[model samples]
Target: MHGPDRDGELWRRSRVAVSPDGDVVGAISVLRNPSHSGRFSVSLEVRPDHRRQGIGTALIEVARGLRPEPLPLSAKAHTTDLAAMALLQAVGGRIYQQCPGRRPDPTSPEIRSWAGIQAVPSGVRLDPLNGVTADALAVAWVAQYLWSHEAWSPVTSPDTLAQRLREGLADLDPATSTGAWIGDELVATSLVLREPDGAVTLVAETIRRDQPDGVRLVAAALARCMTLLGDAAVTNVLIDGHESDLHLAPVLATLPPTPAEPLLLVEIP
Candidate 1:
């Protein structure tokens, strides 16, 4: 066993377990979340051959002992992973949110049907997020994100969001990323992202809670986003939604249902 070594710059600590033969078997890491001060996000993995042993429990104990104060740990796992959920449960972890993960066909008729639909609420204009300053884009994203009613949504500030956008801008599909505006005010956005794993995703939301046509604006942006999927050469696009999502959920429901799994975010307090 080794480490709970601190990386001060990143505000993280990690531990690793190695077998007597010098083979690494498992590892765990805890990172401080920028949005939630003092709280930590945890990631753990154990080699299959080392499973059923006490390694996982021992690691959790070590994680708790890293600091004198109690550690509030947050972790994400698929509900299909029975063993992982069991371990989380053993450590007093409770489900904080349930995120629905779906992989809908990008070439579906429903998607194609929205290709030519330009009907949006009166006075609203649809446009791609090209040439938009990161600061401006982040402000718009944060506004909608806060009012999204998504259980798994994290609290974010404009600075953090801007930095994130700058870092991931290379993967952002500008041609397919659409925004809704009433004159100069951005009301909604649907961003298409190409993941490092080669998967694509469409994230759409309404930014203004008070805007009566918020949902319509989001739907229109998403519709435009779907229509441009072909231009991006995307065959599969994943979307994450919360059951209680105020606007995004309703827009997703209009599409044909696809196979989805429940992704759980667990917290240990």
Candidate 2:
């Protein structure tokens, strides 16, 4: 596993060990969303058979020396997975947040109705994914950061923001990333990403947390994503909520969303 693969700006992932045959035995990843600095996160993986062998600890050693001033790190692990959970705790991990994974049964009448917002909020409109431009997306990022309540870095200048937007756009599946608009300003954003398992996850960002129609705008974004899904059934949706976000948890709770997994943040000492 060869990488520290410089992903987009401010991100890199590294593989610390590989077997003689070249299979990945262990790896470590570093991610600092310009939006989340002290809250930066890292992920570590070791072949199951290789655990109890101290690889996780060694990798932590490498991660502790990470560049850009050694900010705190976070990672998610399943709640019931004892080994994974224990390994993280061994390294001082704790539950900073818990985002339940929900599989929204697309056939449910409730969800079906959300596909097209019955009543879009006043003076605001949901824009098609195609309607989003780079500048608007950058603005959306700023909004997400502001509304997010996570203490991460704010985009500082036009050039830096533009570059970050370009990098983000390259990773977005435009058909799935939709926006909310007030006149020309992009006020909110949502993305439904299709994972390799064929499950689509719903994530949303609204600039104004208190907007009267904030919740509906998110629903509209998911609705548009459902349109892109076409006939393929969406059997899984993972809703990740930060401790401070006001809407996601409550809205998803209405789906009576079940607790599918417990997301744990492993604190790197």
Candidate 3:
């Protein structure tokens, strides 16, 4: 069992079971989302010897008790983790989005060039996120909202969310990170990370739902980042939430197919 201090960091209580001789054999942690209305993610780990027992199911039941009713939950399962997948499925998870591992074809110059072409709407403008301002913070929050509705893991607090954004922005090379706005209201955002071998990855991209021509706004923002990265071969851009939103699906369909990494969302009644 995790002690109080460990439990605090996990954002919820945890339960552990030990063998008769006092060997720790299984553990599970439940976390509540500090930002969203009511959501949680439960993670479990069990020792090999404890397998085939009802321990995993019991741990989930305990975690479920920590939260209120009408809970919407989700879990990320590795493609190879058959046991974990089975457990999550048994608990009522359904695969929603898949993250496909892909390699950029060197012959696909057209695709790279397409990503670099900015199609900015007449009045919208793109800019780098100024982390020190309230406006930037608002934009970041909206971006986080978009993320929360997508396949992202739950966060425990506003402070944690702020810290994550700060760290993420600081780690970004200015030339590859950017945000967009119309007049003063932030509308779209996208980020790119360049690898040592001259490959680039599109880390996260979002456009406020209220924005007019949101999809175009996001595409323009991505194009700006791609241009700034300047010929750093984009290996593959894994666009999340594409399957849930048709707008995103069309955008992703433009790219080549590769290995799919499934993301499962669950809700227990």
Candidate 4:
């Protein structure tokens, strides 16, 4: 291990890697996303100078040893990081999702045209995060719980899920977090958080597959978030769409996002 384990509030956990000579070389983090259930979303990184030294691999092994069992691990890599991809494959990771990269300008006319297509699915109405009541949130959580099973993830405690929502709405600001509802049932939701650098990022955007509104909820949330980011020139839009989410893959594929590498995922066997 490179340093002491970092255990943060709200169930976030991480471990670091150290070189044989006592130098910190890399690290790995696992977000036990309550929505994803059993699988942990993993990120592995090694210092550039430590390339090909097995540091990344070692870090993964360490992380796996420390995480929950029967829960397969997942990590993302870009095409530019050939070494990382190779290392992941050498250790049995396979690409599961293709994450889209950012474009130079999110405000471009072409992308601006996408908003219409991503608008609210039929029969669904959008509501601000602040207006959502506990009962409604429970409906969203239940929808997520059912979705998690299909995605092969474990459904976390309702309290944990609610806490996750609070952190998101607070971190992203309720003005930017919005949900989709049909009558009283929460069917879809999307929340965006703005980086200090001024670029906005998508935090949560989901709609129940069974709902007629489909994935259009993301469009409504996105349009609202972009409006919330008024005056900020949004040249970049970052989306992390893993392969596990089949619904998101097509959206990324159809768009001409900025010239950047797509995300690749590997699953530990």
Q: In order, how many clashes per candidate?
A: 0, 1, 1, 7
Show the colliding residue pairs in model 4. Answer: 37-153, 37-154, 38-153, 38-154, 94-266, 97-243, 103-258
Error of 2 at 117 (Å): 8.4
Off by over 4 Å in 2: 1-35, 39-41, 65-70, 113-119, 122-124, 152-165, 170-178, 181-186, 193-199, 220-243, 258-262
Deviation from native of the Cα of residue 223 in model 2, angstroms: 4.5
Model 3 TM-score relative to the real fold: 0.69
lDDT of 1 by residue, 71-165 (tens): 58878889899999999998899887777787666677756775456368999888998867776776776666666633454554446545665
Query: Model 3, residue 266: displacement in angstroms?
Result: 2.3
Q: Which residues of candidate 3, in runs, are more than 4 Å off?
A: 1-11, 66-74, 94-111, 122-124, 127-140, 143-168, 183-185, 192-207, 227-242, 245-249, 258-260
Report lDDT (CA) for all predictions: 0.74, 0.64, 0.59, 0.61
lDDT of 4 by residue, 57-126 (tens): 7877876777755577877677788887788888888765555554434566666655545656667787
In model 1, the Cα lDDT at residue 264 comes to 88
Residue 190 local lDDT, model 3: 64
**lDDT tens digits, residue span 32-77, model 2:** 6554555556777888888888888888778777656657776767
Each candidate: RMSD: 3.2, 4.8, 4.9, 4.6
Which predicted model would earn the best TM-score?
1
